[model samples]
Target: MSDANKKAIRTAIQTGIGVAAALPMIVAASGVPAALPWVAGALAVAGGVARVMALPVVQALLPSWLRTDSSASRR
Candidate 1:
């Protein structure tokens, strides 16, 4: 697969995993009901954001918050 496609897929997977992990905390902190669908909804939102950010133009224009060194090219 092309690198762009790979990147997008990777981003989506990571976002889903992250949202899943945070599902409990987000619900608890927000005092929202701990219904199962809330977790699914959060993951959907995160996935959509990741998809938007996966666009080449958006990726190019946005500085990655997790970057340790901004000087070099990212993997």
Candidate 2:
């Protein structure tokens, strides 16, 4: 696969893992019903996909000082 595609998949997986790990704590802190956590997990996955797809645009919009160098180049 192309580098860009690989990067996107990596980002999506990382984001999903982060969201899944945080969901329980978030739900517990808010004292919301248990069923709502499933909805939150779904939203997190959607948001992760959207963010991965938009990453290039986001990087372009950020100022140079705020942007990190591509770590993939170091691999």
Question: lDDT scores for all predictions?
Answer: 0.66, 0.64
* After superposition, candidate 2 runs with Cα above 4 Å error: 35-75
Q: Each model's RMSD to truth, in Å?
A: 10.0, 10.6
**Candidate 2, residues 35-71: lDDT per residue as tens digits?**
6767666656666755654476555555565444453
Task: List TM-scores for all candidates, in order.
Answer: 0.46, 0.44
Model 1 / residue 22 / CA error / Å: 0.7
Best model number under lDDT = 1
Candidate 1, residue 56: the lDDT equals 62
For residues 1-75, what per-residue lDDT tens digits would candidate 1 score against the true structure?
999999999899877757765655777798776566866677566667666656665555556774334442253
List candidate 1 segments past 4 Å from native: 35-75
